[model samples]
Target: MQDAGFVWNAEELDAFIESPRKHVRGTNMSYPGERRPEKRAAIIEYLTQLSTAD
Candidate 1:
């Protein structure tokens, strides 16, 4: 979201994953969110791994 000045770092990613709409108002993301903290953490971890894979 360059227009919104949103950065995609881990901490921002965590909050955005928790609630897309709340984190970035007017977001088109339809998925509600991962309500469980553990699950969210897992998702973020998996994503991080994917991004770093070589």
Candidate 2:
């Protein structure tokens, strides 16, 4: 992803989370993607919690 010029920040993460393959062509991720806005938000929120947990 670094080679693709992806900074992997929140905005980029959000886009990637929405559509992995579309956002990063050639991605190995097989997740069709979360079509629901609330689900996506929950996923991001959960990931945020995981990152901040200590």
Candidate 3:
């Protein structure tokens, strides 16, 4: 899945990590309206750092 340019939202990401088939519906070629993992991960990591900093 990572080989192709597939993006995932928060809910989508959660669902995907848990079960790719269940969450991923419709088109297999593309993930309808989703954010990139790198972007999402960066945001999450940043938030974690901020929380820890506080």
Error of 1 at 41 (Å): 0.6
lDDT of 1 by residue, 1-54 (tens): 556576788888888888988988888999898778888889889999999999
Give the backbone clash total of model 3: 0
- Specify the highest-lDDT model's number: 1
Put down candidate 2 lDDT per residue, 1-54, tens digits, no spaces.
667686766777778888999999888988888777788778888888999999
Give me the displacement of residue 38 in model 2, in angstroms: 0.8
TM-score of candidate 1 relative to the true fold = 0.85
Segments in model 1 whose C-alpha atoms lie over 4 Å from true places: none
Report the Cα lDDT for candidate 1: 0.84
Q: After superposition, how far is residue 27 of candidate 1 from its true place, in Å?
A: 0.8
* Residue-level error in angstroms, candidate 1, position 25: 1.0
Question: lDDT tens string, model 3, 1-54?
Answer: 554346644555544644455455543644343346666566556765777794
